[model samples]
Target: MSVTAVNDVNFATQIRKEGATLVEFGASWCPPCKVLLPILDELSEQHGEKLRILKVDCDESPATASQFGVMSMPTVIVFHNGEPVEKLIGLRPKSVYENVLAKYS
Candidate 1:
């Protein structure tokens, strides 16, 4: 599955979709967010429909960021059954991501 961009309006919808959803709350200019893009892409391909990856731009959707209490860029939240199950902050290795999400997928 390809990564999909979400905004304040659609953030809830994306997170509540069937199965597990990984939402990255970030800004376009955030360095860590940029570094994570390729890793997420690779994982998306590997997981296919087992996982749904979504991105929310903090700059474009401040309310959504605030709702999630994102104090920093590149905050990744994993959601299942319409609720958050895991969260990661700042820069993280690809293995770390896989470890956090593998069970859910």
Candidate 2:
């Protein structure tokens, strides 16, 4: 599975879905956010069965970004049962994400 794009309009419904949801708050101009895209894609494919991966462009979805208190590009928040449980700031190694997913999966 590939990471689905989410905007302020649907962000609430998407994250509220059953199971673990990983939301990446970023923008197109952010270099690190660009680099993190492929990693998220890989993660989506690898953990699709156990997790839902979504991306929220900060520039395009400012309201949702602000609601999550995302101050930087590539801020990743892991949500379980509609509540945020863990937050990862900046770009991180794939293993770090895998470790987080393991905790919730």
lDDT of 1: 0.88
Clashing pairs in 1: none
What C-alpha root-mean-square deviation, in Å, does candidate 2 show against the real structure? 0.9
Candidate 1 C-alpha error for residue 40, in Å: 0.6
Residue pairs with clashing backbones, model 2: none
TM-scores for all candidates: the values are 0.94, 0.96
lDDT of 2 by residue, 33-80 (tens): 999999999998888677889999999999999998999889999999
Candidate 2's TM-score: 0.96
> What is candidate 1's CA lDDT for residue 18?
65
**Candidate 1 weakest ten by summed lDDT:** 10-19
**Tens-place lDDT digits, model 1, residues 3-47:** 899999988877755678889999998988999999999989988
RMSD of 1: 1.0
Taken over the whole model, the C-alpha lDDT of each candidate is: 0.88, 0.92
Each model's backbone clash number: 0, 0
